[model samples]
Target: MSEVQELTKTKEKPLWYVVFTYHNAEKRVEEHINSLAKTEKYDGLIIKAEVPVQKRTVSRRGKIKEIEEKIFPGYVFVKAVMTPEVMAAIRRINGVAHFVGGGNEPVPITPEEVKRARIQDDLSEEFKAGDTVMITDGPFENFIGKIIKIEGRKINIALSLFDREMGIDFSPEQIMKIQ
Candidate 1:
């Protein structure tokens, strides 16, 4: 391997970063930042630094589909402490133009927010459209529905009124979700 490529492989991975403002520099910045990670091993502290990425598809006519990569671009996240040395090393890296939300001091990104961001970044699976649902949202405040039909926000439910089995049409707000 080339000397440069070999050097690249020795870099440490940092986790949990609050990278800010790479808005259009995801790819370039990853390479640049990772390279810097090696040139300056701030410490044995870097965890896993990365720019989260995901893909999406667009449907076309004739049932045709095309896949595309979505970039949250211009954001670099590093999973490391904000120690003077580590922060100094990160600042020295390319593509990391600034910290998240913008401020002079180093800001730590919360794990919860980061987890939610990572989880929602991609839609792995969709709701099964479960057997028709029934919910009563009006005067029939105590009513609920099974599987009927949903149009816009209107849901038709098969609810038992009094003691008679029947299908009632009502807004989801009027009904409560029950087993």
Candidate 2:
């Protein structure tokens, strides 16, 4: 390639950067960036917005269910040529917390890390608070409990064990919802 062509190519090439968004708001933020990129000004400056997710399987009442989980909750990856205008536009989107970099400038994620983060890990099961479930793994295996709270993959349950009430936390993969 000619020197000028090489220079322009390098300048226009997009790098992967991480952006923070409100928990569970990755899709919204991605759509917002997509709309903005379509505008006349940001057309080529912003390239892609992605939310990496994985499929999981869980059993409930003898039935299995597949669920999609975010690999990095509250964060999204964007491929774009870093520029003041592009950054500002992304920052202005609702639900965007900020770029992952702590300082004044944004830091791009390494190509290797980006590749790893994009891999989908499959798992099983989904449950909600107030559902009765049975532990399938961990120390409480075979114990029946009622889900009292759910935070990401962790589940807090209230169970009656040894004639007393106890509260414990477990991962969704370790418990099965029972009707």
TM-score for each candidate, following the candidate numbering: 0.46, 0.60
What lDDT is reached at residue 6 by model 2?
A: 46
Worst 10 residues of 2 by lDDT: 119-128
Question: Model 2, which residues run further than 4 Å from truth?
Answer: 1-10, 119-179
Poorest lDDT segment (10 consecutive residues) of candidate 1: 119-128
Tell me the whole-model lDDT of each prediction, alpha carbons only: 0.53, 0.76
Q: Compared with the true structure, what per-residue lDDT tens digits does model 2 show for residues 1-179?
A: 76434443344445689999997889999898877767889866776688898999999899999999889999988877789999998998999999998697889887578769973211122356688777777888767788888775567899898899898988655765554
Model 1, span 1-179: residue lDDT tens: 86434433453222356666545766666666556555546434554466766666667785756564544556766655456677776676665677765566666666476665562321111101234332323565534446455554455566677888776666433443322
Supply every candidate's count of residue pairs whose N, Cα or C atoms clash at under 3 angstroms: 23, 7
Global local distance difference test of model 1: 0.53
Which residue pairs clash in candidate 2?
56-123, 56-124, 57-123, 57-124, 57-125, 58-124, 58-125
What is the Cα-based TM-score of model 2? 0.60
